[model samples]
Target: MVFFGDSMLETLGRVVVFLLVVLVVLLASLLSLFFVMLRTKRILFPNFVLFIVSLLYEILCRLLSFFRVDPTLIDRVSVEMRNALNYTEFAATDPRERILLLPQCIRSIDCPARLDSLEGICCVECRGCAIGELSARSREIGIRMYISPGGTFTERILTRSKPKAVVGVSCYPNLYEGLLKAKLMGVPAQGVPLSAAGCVKTTVDCEEVMNKCKIRS
Candidate 1:
């Protein structure tokens, strides 16, 4: 009995060491891919890199912080990678089957839009901010637009609307979460990162958004 117990302990120790080695290898590979992407603005082995990023997201961020690097760098790269991976499917969806979600922060400070339980913010196109122009363009292409009040509202919109594809504009962190959510829901989504991020009076690149919205061609 004593000999069997000792063997069991040794086996467990070996398994733990193997897992630690694997973790270190994955972390090193992910960091290498991240630096390459940053320098080249190109993704290599995108799906593999994304898997590592998702698997070690928290730990990787903490590691970056320890090295005095901006942790959100990985988040930004992951978002871009997701966009590239989903672009073909997203572009194939019909305009009518797509929806555009804009963050509430991008709205003008004096915006007159009112929030509803069902539809979120109702944009009246008062021309107060880029949203009005975007709303107009979305209408021209037969795509529905929503100004999300928060993450919960965004989920509700997706659940209720059930669009085939989505175009979302937000900061990098929110964009990363939103993309992952869409993927889990079996929806293809394209994200446009906000040019200036803030709680209120934020700014987005309206032209870049329109370009993404019409990426079908």
Candidate 2:
């Protein structure tokens, strides 16, 4: 019994350490991105400072949960994400506007058995991530959400739909590209970047989008 207790404690300790390391890495990445933005003159220092502070708060909450000091913050993050989702606007009320959900990495057709399914095409309804939920929500909202695995497919969807506005899910680079394309084409666009959770799929709250659109109750 004592040995088992010790083993469990050790495992817990390791998990805490891992979480701390991840938090540090996330902070570093944010700082690096902010610096890059500064160099490129994309964002002002005030906005950068605000972003850094927000990120630090989120990281602190995550770290607290890692040590079992406060599990509530994990729920807070979920709530915040949901609220953020509400702040995004979709293109139309016609139920045909195209909203794209792009995954960074996808499973390849010729890869090994395990990797074969990793490609976005084989989105087996495993519900391993938030993609399923986001898809369901998109359907509920009468918006078309495509699971695009690459840039080519994403562009193809855009070319086909010609949506008035877009809510895209991608990394920084893809988000920037999509924003540029939208600007050039006079399409309003909102992007939600994926975090480090390895859950390539995303979580979007419909209420948030509705709120952004100022839709009536």
Clashes of each: 0, 5
TM-score winner? 1
TM-score of each: 0.92, 0.44
Q: Please provide, for model 1 over 1-217, each residue's C-alpha lDDT reduced to its tens digit, 9 standing for 90 to 100.
A: 3655878999999999999999999999889888988999987998998888888999999999999999989879999999999988998988889999999998899999998989999999999888999999999988999999995988889999999999999999899999999999999999999999999888888889888888884
After superposition, candidate 2 runs with Cα above 4 Å error = 1-96, 104-124, 197-217
TM-score of 2: 0.44
Clashing pairs in 1: none
Model 1 CA deviation exceeding 4 Å by range: 1-7
- Please name the candidate that would achieve the greatest lDDT relative to the true structure: 1
User: How accurate locally, in lDDT, is each candidate?
Assistant: 0.91, 0.51
